[model samples]
Target chain A: MRRENTRIFEKETTGSFMNKEFIAINALLTVEQAILYLRENVRDKRNIYYVYIINEHDRLIGALSIRELLSKDSNRLVSEVKVSKIIFFKTDIDQEEAVKVFRDTDLVSIPVVNENGKLIGVVHVEDILDVMQQEATEDFHRMAPVSQKLDGGLIESTIGALYRKRIVWLIILVFINVFSGAGIAHFQDVIEANIALVFFLPLLVDSGGNAGSQSSTLVIRAMATGDIHLKDWFRMFTKEVVLSMAMGFTMALAVSAVGLMRGGVTIAIVVSITMVCIVVVGSLVGMSLPFIFRRLKLDPATASAPLITSICDITGVLIYFGIANKLLNL
Target chain B: MRRENTRIFEKETTGSFMNKEFIAINALLTVEQAILYLRENVRDKRNIYYVYIINEHDRLIGALSIRELLSKDSNRLVSEVKVSKIIFFKTDIDQEEAVKVFRDTDLVSIPVVNENGKLIGVVHVEDILDVMQQEATEDFHRMAPVSQKLDGGLIESTIGALYRKRIVWLIILVFINVFSGAGIAHFQDVIEANIALVFFLPLLVDSGGNAGSQSSTLVIRAMATGDIHLKDWFRMFTKEVVLSMAMGFTMALAVSAVGLMRGGVTIAIVVSITMVCIVVVGSLVGMSLPFIFRRLKLDPATASAPLITSICDITGVLIYFGIANKLLNL
Candidate 1:
């Protein structure tokens, strides 16, 4: 059905997938009469789960399931038997927002109305399951920062297409990482004085990126699912301060042991202090990127692991060497 | 309702969320009489969408939607009216598998049966939205390699809890990255000869990790969504070879430009060669870990960005230094 669409509703809107074969009964029809009307019209409708009630203007005024109508008085008009408090979507509602409606109302189908409240179509739960899956897949792909939408399966995508999608981010990131190289070059004296500092370079920088990746992934995913919101940043920041400090302290203890074994007390202290500071910095940087993205009206999911890692690498290099320079007096 | 469970269905099985208040009718009864039976009993039932048909032995036989019954012959026996080819789940079926069933069938609800084929309960599509969201969240957290599941919202989790979750992966990764440090230490002779080599180290190594991360994340997400199965690995591997070579060549070009400006033609040639080799190796490592994890019956999602980055960092260090040793001739 989707392949037949010229546009593929890639806007991911409720209107794009709305079923126009919906059967809306006259509000004046009795339960028996509505059954007769539905029996004649709803034979091949995919969204046969419910019969909506529309008034003179064809506005969706109420809705009731056929199962619920079964227990109602047959002579009573559907207007009297229907659930008057209608939960519905406008034609332009985002698929994700529509999904939230389904989650909150527990309704199998919803009427899609125009802004004027006239029923134009219906959205069924059947299509919504696919929508949720597709939305989640997009988030996963975007968080990878792969420009290709994975419209088809990965195996089906051509090598050129895959390369095109992947190279964009890798190129951008590689250039972004030049700053980390510059950061290293800027602190060349510190590195030259104690060449042993290079041993913990990958270990320390990767730790910062790793810690950042964890926070960014959590925050981006939480935002996607509506679990966390923009307003919660202050509270989340406070929470992260304690979390990163604890993480930083534990990481410092662990790395200092490696520091002591490899380069004695001076190197041990430098790496340990760097570890604590960088972890705290990396985590906060990771936790904050999504919020910054959201504020800038970019997708929070694009605060991806690679992007955060590149940014953190620069910071980690500067911090690691700065601490070493002061401690070792290079 | 989930909170009331002494167990929160942490196993995430279908039985954990099934609605036991389902209505079933005697197959011997006429459709008219069955309707009367349902109208009396289904008023308070949560699984009101479908009424199942049970035989004399209480074995599951057929099921029909009340909406479908509205169009059926009133006096027809339910055995004759019902659709006998019923879709159902056994008590122990996983929730993820159940979600697949819903996606495929487009049914609002499905019956759950015991081993002997007695209808014990029903699972509704309403509950499935939450299940998919939860499953997706778990995949997100585990890919972050956070051990603590985001049981409540992230903002709601204690600092201690968040710290514990974030620290486990960070600690493991730091130890795993010891190989990278060891790899650099072993190459001390190569680095001591050309101090300029240290400048491009982070940029080049992170490119490999960044590229590799893209591949691993795509594979892991595709596996989770049933987009690609384990059997497709060879086909995907062939595709990846071409894809990675293209990406490797592009990244080499991008970085060699930096290599040329920073350290003349000789450094450029070494960095460019290292870039191509490391990117290819990293991508393969990233793509292969998920398949290996799946083969071991572990979650492929654990082939997270950070885990793959750490492993690739070790490989990248070795590849970078090994190439520099031969080319620079220290």
Candidate 2:
């Protein structure tokens, strides 16, 4: 049976990629036939990295690199000098996981195997790098909240694809802004009376959004890397609370100083007090929302910087007006 | 010199855990000394995985793993067998980049270095993970447009802090909303005449913001990983365009079907065309903004999902109204 297989192997090599093809040698092949066949027919023997020794059923038993083969006695059978122990990837495994393994092991290439343990293909390190780059790009895009498949293609083609992915979300956010507009218009009397409030309003919202974004980015990134597990919600919440307090106090002192410098006592008090309250609430909300999304088994990234910022925009307005109504007798 | 170092090392490990002072090791010792010290004196070597092999000047020369010692020939000289290949992090390197390397390598610990190659401190992978988790949470909060720090303590103590972070941004966004309101108010005559248009406004803005966020996320993530360099701006922009077109057309078709179901033919045509154009533009803007920020050496993450979304919200409204004004002949 092994002899018959060797005869078939010789016939198949006649049509394959001459420099890249592998020649399977049965353990029974005489040393003379193996050397002659390699020397005469295989013109690119130097390029062939390994000569696999196989069993009668075509199972890989051992391998010999070309250098190893030449170092041995020329008369020795290929199987006599073969080295054991091979690492390979199974076909059923995920490509992403396979890429990770490729990176971790620093293997030049990995052999692919079918479910039955038969050799299928080879995954090169270069290919894994390409995959990693593509996946990282896709993750970044996903974080942005656009959806699209990533693949190798022309720049023009990719841009056209990107445009389609982005537009729908923009429309939704725009319309959402109308609600925010309604929130503002509802407070028209407040704005008219405290026109100074209008001046600080943009600064407040932009800062609040920035702060909230900082929290969400941190949380989402943590969740992505598996550093903070779902079970650590309480611990995370506790940590966020403490961090927010320190941050809020520090920011309030700064903002209050700025307000005092620019807007006098009443405005300073109002801005400082409001600044402290809004930042604390925003930080907690930003940190917790991603956890909530993750608990729901949704993509935590969907609880993104922009979504949180918009939510804060609406909430900040309500809080500002509510606080002002009580404190400033509005 | 080695004998003198060994005599000094023997004098340092003499106390119990409760009474023991943690004396920092300043110089590299032999593998036998490392093993003996760790085995008898160091109670919690779980956190410190390797012994740093340093030169006399405290320059990191190599590392010796405890596990490697356990498996290797125990009688061999430490210098002869210690692994010389060392991967380390410089102190001035950005924490973000450090986190990525930590995640990718999955090392138990990494040595930190200064500009002159002097050893600073060992950044245990666990500590890096802690920092990463905290940062991620903070980013999440900032993304929400909140201004406070959110990770370090109890919620009760931090509530005030949360308020500070959240309120300022909310106030600013509230005022910013006025501009959006003004935009809508400018078109009040148009909206009142076509009340149906008002109903679709929210959906459009939301979709546009979402689309923009998707693009921003992808671009930002690509930037983070060093996959998309500043030089690849043209490629990134072109890809965004292609992706946007494909996504925009698909969404337009879907929205058109919805419009036809709700409104008459004119409304359907207006909404569909507006949807495609707004989404396409939103995606392009979202994709490009991060790269622009990166070019400016500003953090691409600062452009964020919420910032992009909010900006897209305003743009989407303008586009929707502009298209409606022209197409509806209002």
Candidate with top lDDT is 1
Clash tally, candidates in order: 0, 143
Docking class of 1: medium
Give, for candidate 1 chain A, the lowest lDDT window spanning 10 residues. Answer: A1-10
Top of the candidates by DockQ: 1
Candidate 2 residue-wise lDDT at B220: 68
For residue A293, give model 2's deviation from the true position in Å. 7.9
In order, candidate lDDTs are 0.85, 0.58
Q: Per-residue alpha-carbon lDDT of model 2 for B1-330, expressed as tens digits? A: 233223222211111001111212323455456555544544433344455666667677677554454334445656667677888766555566666666566355677655566555665543443444455445444445546665444223344654565556544554454455456645555555555564465456656667776767666665665557778888777666666677767777766766776557877888888878777788788878988888888978777666776687677777887888887784
Compare the candidates by TM-score and give the number of the best one.
1
Alpha-carbon deviation at B23 in model 2, angstroms: 11
**Model 2: what TM-score?**
0.54
- lDDT (10s digit) by residue, model 1, range B304-324: 878888888889999999999
